[model samples]
Target: MSVEVVIPNATPGTGEGPHWDDSTRSLVFVDITQKNVFRWDSVTGSLQKVHLEDEVGCVVPCKKGGFLVAVGRTIFHLEWSSQKLTKLHEIPLKGVGNRFNDGKCDPAGRFWIGTMGKVLSFEPLTFDMEKGELYCLDVDGSFHKRLDKMTICNGLAWSSDHKTMYFIESIPGQIMAFDYDVTSGNICNRRTVVNFGEFDPTDPENLGIPDGMTIDTNDNIWVAFYGTGQVICFNPQTGKMLRKIEIPCKRTTSCCFGGENLDELYVTTAQAGSTEEEREAFPASGSVFRVTGLGVKGHPANVFNGNF
Candidate 1:
C-alpha cells in the first residue's frame, strides 16, 4: 500500500515536535535551529509563524488557553493573542549544556518534557550521551525529575488505554516502555520495546535512529527515522516491524495526528546539516508532511492542565 504526503509548510532548519490542535483544527511544529514556531490550518491551508529569542523545541496546547512551549531550559505559557510568553517555570538543568527537547501532555493532563545536552553534535556526532534528564511538570506547578542521564530525549506517547507510556532517548537508539499510572502521572518498570540495533545504519532499508513517534487507534507505533527518509510502523507490543512509509526528505524527525476525523498523520523532517549534494537529493527536507488514508486514527493530543 502507498500513502501520499502533502507538505503544508517548508522550514529552513531542523523541524521537530509536531502537535495536533483539535480545538483549532490545525498542526503546530517547531524549527529548532530557526527558533520559530509554526501553526498550519488544516482547512484554510494557511501557515502562521512565531519567533522566539532562543531555540524552540516543542509546543503543545494548554487546557485553559494558549500554548505550553519549551524554549531552551524554560517552559512558558505562550499566548498567541498578545504574542506573549508568560513564564510558568524553568528547569534547573541549565549551565550544564542541557536544553529542553520533545515534550507532551499525558492523559492526566500533566506535561512531560525531556532535555538534551548541547555538548552533543550530530554533524560529527560526538558528546556525552548521559547528560540529559526528563522532567514532569505537575498540575500543581511543581517539577519532578523522573529520568536522568539521557542524551537526546525525544518521542513521548501514551497507549490508548493509558496503561503504558513510551519514551525515547534518541542517542541510545532504543525506545523504552513503562508501566503508566494515568491517575498519578507516573511511569515505572521501564523495558525496551524497540531497539534500533536490529537495523543497520549503512543499509538504506534501515537508515538512522528513531527520532519521534505517534500512536494509531490500534496501538501500533509509527516512528520517523532521522536520516532514513521514511516513517516506519511497528507492533510495539510484539517488537515487530509492520510497515514503512517512505518520505521525500532524508531527515524525518517527528509526527502526530490531526484533521477533523483525526486520521491525518502529520510528519516533520530536518535539513539543517545537509551538504549541497544531500540537499539536491532530498529537496523536500525540513518540510511538514500530511499523510492520510493510513486506515488508522490517532488520539487527540492532551492539553496541559498547569497554569499559564
Candidate 2:
C-alpha cells in the first residue's frame, strides 16, 4: 500500500484522536504533549491549530456547534473561530494520578471518554496502577461512569447495527467487545473479541499494543497498533485478522475514516516515546498519513450533543 503524508509534522509529541467532522468537512486531531488541536481540509489542503494550556487528549465536534475537548481531566467546549474554551464537565479521579485519553461520541450523541494514570517508573518498568475508567457525558450535561480498571483507554467503535461496541485498553493487547444498547448507551456482556495473543511475543517491535480503531461497513475493525508500525483489520465476529497495512512510523497512535467518500483512512503517528535510532529511521514519525483503495467505507462520526 502506498502511504501519503497528509501533514509533514502533525505534532511534536503524541498525535492522537482523529475525528472527522462532517459538518465542517474537516479532520480534527490532537497533539497531547504539545497541547495542540488541529483541523485540516483535504480538498483545500489548509491546516489550522488551536493551542490549549493543558494536554489536549481528544477533540470531537458537537452538533450544537464548536467542539468538546478532553484535556487534563476536564472536557471543555471550544470555539475554533474565536479560540474560546469553556469548561463542560470534568472526569473525577480523586487522588489518583490519571488524566483523560482517547474518546469519541456514541451514536446517541453522548460523549464517551476514558483516562490513564500519569505516574510511570522505569526501574522495574511500571505505569500508574490506578486503573482506567470510561465515562460518558450525557445529553443533559451529566457525566456517568461506564467501565472500569483499564490501562490507557484508547480506541472506540460501534457496529453498523449499533448493537456492539468495540473498545481498547493499550496495555491489554486486545480489542474487547460488549453488548451495546443504542437507546440507553449502555454496554454489557464484555468478552475478548480480538486478542493479539497470536502475535510473536519474542519481537519487541510487534507487541500488539492496540491504540485506536474504526469500523467498516462490513463490521471489520481497523486498529492501529502502537510500537508495531501497522494498522490491522480484524473480524471480531470471526476472531480473525483479515489484513494488515504496514506504516513507516513506529508509534501508530490512532485512525479514523474520512475524505470525500469516507473511504480514505487518516492515520496519526507519534515520535515522542521512540528511541533516537527509531526516530531517525522513520523521519516522518509525527506526520499524519492517508491510505486509500481499501474498498470499504466507515460510518460517519457521531456529532456531540452539547444541548446541556
Among all candidates shown, the one with the greatest lDDT: 2
Residue range 1-308, candidate 2, lDDT tens digits? 56889898788798999998776679999999899999998768899999999888899998888899988989899998999988877766644568888999988998899888773742222468647889998898888998787777889999988899999877757788999998988889999886764345357656557889999889999999877788999899987889898889978889999987899899999877667888789999999999988889998999887575
Question: Alpha-carbon error at 117 in model 2, in Å?
Answer: 0.9
- Which segments of candidate 2 are over 4 A away from where they belong? 94-96, 119-126, 197-207
Candidate 1 TM-score to native: 0.94
lDDT measured at residue 268 in model 1 versus the true structure, 0 to 100: 94
Per residue, candidate 1 scores C-alpha lDDT tens digits across 153-226 of 88998899999999887786898999999988878899999888644556765648788988988998889888
CA lDDT of each prediction against the hidden true structure:
0.84, 0.85
